[model samples]
Target chain A: MRISVQLKDFDIGKELKLFNNGDTNIGAVVSFHGIVRNNSEKSLMHMDIEQYPGMTQKAISNYVEMAVERWSLYDALVIHRHGKLLLGDRIMMVATAARHRRDAFQSAEFLMDYLKSRAPFWKKEVTKDGYQWVKSVLDDESALERWR
Target chain B: MIKVLYFAWVRERIGVPYEIVETQSGTVMELVEELKQKEPRYEIAFSDLSAIKVAINQELCEFDTKLNGAIEIAFFPPMTGG
Candidate 1:
C-alpha cells in the first residue's frame, strides 16, 4: 500500500522488485503507465499539471484504500508526477500485486480508473495555436462510476 | 473559520486561489449563499453552481454536508486529469 505524488520519475523495475521481494506468495503483478501524448485535436504542444498539496494525497489515498478493500489486493502502488510535462513524459503509474491474477488485474484497473476521474489534478494544454484547459470526459467518469 | 479554495477555471474567474472566511457551521450550499452575499466578486464567482464541484477535506463532497470542523473547502470544475 504505497502511494506517492512526486515531482521525480519512478523506476518501474525498482518498484516492482520492492513489492515482490521475499514474497513467494505473490504470484501476479500488473502495472500500467500513463504518458503524455504528443498531440491533441486542439494542436496541443505540452501540458501543465497542477495539484493541491495535501488534498491530492488524500484523494489518492482514499481511492487506493477503496481499491484494496474491493479487490482484496496484496499490495498497490500509485505514483503521479506534477509540473510541466512534455509529450512522451510519464504522467503516472499504477502497480498491483496479489496471489492470483484476478485480484491484481482488477486492482490495477480500479486504481487507474479512479485516478483518471477522481484525482484533483488539472491539465492545461499548450498548443501552437494557443492554450486551453482539457475538458472532463464523460466516458472516463462512467468508467470509474462502476467501482463506486 | 475554514479556508476556501478555488482552482483552474474557477480560480481564473474568481481572480484568487483561496481565502479565509468565518461562517457558522452550515451546509456547503448555505455557505455558497453566504459567500455570494459578501461582495459582487463572490456573487459572480458563485453565480453558476452547476459548473462547480465541492470538496470537503479533499474528498469529493456534496453541498448538503455540514462543515462543523472542516478545515478546508475546495471549489473547482469537474476534474479533467489523468
Candidate 2:
C-alpha cells in the first residue's frame, strides 16, 4: 500500500509501527531488510545507487500490485533508498501483511525477487581499487522464474 | 526529435546523460545503427548489444520494436537493484 524511494535513511521500528497500526484483521506481518555488505574482494568505500526517477517508481508499483493480487495481501510496504550508502547501512525493506503467515512470507520474498532484477536502480561499488557497476547475477534472474 | 538517455557505464562512455536526436530510423536497431555512425564513443558503447537493454518511453522493449512516435528512448545495462 506504500512505496517510498528516498535519499534519507528510514527507521525500521518506526516504519513497522506505522504499518501495523489500526490493522485488527492482520494476523501475520513479514519483513525483509537489505543491507550493504562489506565482504567484497576489495574493501568497499561506499555504494553509489542510480535510478531513473519516473520509471523506477512505476516499475516498483507494478511489482507491488502483482504481489498483492497473487497473495491476496492485506497490506504491503516497500521502502528503497537511492544515492550513496556505506557498509552495514540499510538499503531497502519490504513488509507484507496478511491474515495468514504463508501469504505474508511468500509475498515479501516475491517482492524482493522482482525488485532485485526488475527495478531501474543501478549500483556502483566504490572499493579500494576503483569503481565498478554490479553485474546482474544469473541466480537472481532464475529466482524470478519460479513465480512465473 | 527523440530524447535519448543513457545510464550507468553507458552514460560514462557516451560522456553525456542524454541527448536530443533527429533520425529517420523506424526501429530501435536502426536508431542504434544511426547512433553508432555518429561517433566512436557511441560505437564503443554499443559494440556489444547483447549486454545492453533498451526502453522505449520508459517501457522495456526488444531491439526490433518499431519506434512509433516514441518521445524517449533509454539505453542501460541490466538492473542490479535492491
Candidate 3:
C-alpha cells in the first residue's frame, strides 16, 4: 500500500506500472482520478489546496487500511496533490487491486467517498470574481451513511 | 499552553495559522468559549459550531473531549478534499 501527498504532478501510467509489479494473483486493478472542474460562476482561474501536513498522511492511511481489510484488497495506492492547480488538472488518484473486480471497484469508490469528506485538505477557488472557499456539499456527507 | 491551529477560512478570519493559548478550560467546549471571548475575529470564525470540526493531537475528536494534557488542538471547517 502507498499514500502520497505531494505538489508535483503524477504520471498515472507510471504509477500503475509500479503498482502491478508482476503480481499474478491480482486479477483486477481499478483506479479513479479526480480533476479540477471549470465550473465556477466566472470561470475558475486556479485553485489553492491547503492541507494539515501532519494529519493528512495519517488520515489517508487509516482509510486505506480500512479499505484493505473490508475489501480484502491485495494492494492500494493513493496520491493526492496539494498547493496550486488549474482547471482540468488531475487533483488525485486512487488505485485498488484485488483478486476479483468487485472488490477492486468497490474499494476504489469507498476510498474516494472517504477522501472527499474525511481528509484534511481544503480547496479555495479563484475565479474572475475573486477568491472563495469551497464549501462541503450535503451530498458528500450523506454518501458516507451507506457504508455505515 | 495548548497549540491551537486553524485552517482554510478559519485561518483567514482568525488572521493567523496557529497560536499558543494558555487557559484553565478543562474541555474543548470551554476552551472554545474562552477563545470566543478573546476577540471578535474568533467569535466570527467560530460562530457556528455545527460548521466547525475539531481535532486533538491531529486526530478527529468531539468538542466535549477533554484537554487531558493534549499538546495540540485544531479547529477548521468540514474538509473538501479529493
Candidate number achieving the greatest DockQ relative to the actual structure: 3
Q: Predictions ranked by TM-score, top down? A: 3, 2, 1
In candidate 1, stretches whose alpha carbon ends up further than 4 angstroms from where it belongs are none
lDDT of 2 by residue, B7-81 (tens): 999999999999999999999999999999999999999999998899899888999999999999999999999
State the lDDT of candidate 2 residue by residue for A39-102, as single tens digits. Answer: 4475899999999888888899999999999998889999999999999899999999999999
* Model 1 Cα lDDT, one tens digit per residue, B33-68: 998887788788788887789999887898898887
- The reply for model 3, stretches above 4 Å from the true place, is A40-42
Per-residue lDDT of B46 in model 2:
99
lDDT values, one for every candidate: 0.84, 0.94, 0.95
Model 3 clash pairs are none
Backbone clashes in model 2, listed as residue pairs: none
TM-score of each predicted structure versus truth: 0.92, 0.97, 0.98
B29-68 in candidate 3: lDDT tens per residue? 9999999999999999999999999999999999999999
For model 2, the superposed segments whose C-alpha errors exceed 4 Å read none
Q: Which tens-of-lDDT digit does each residue in A1-148 have in candidate 3?
A: 9999999999999999999988899999999999999763758999999999989999999999999999999999999999999988999999999999999999999999999999999999998888899999999999898888
For residues A42-115, could you state the per-residue lDDT of candidate 1 as single tens digits? 36678888887888888899888888888777788899988888888989999888889989998898888888
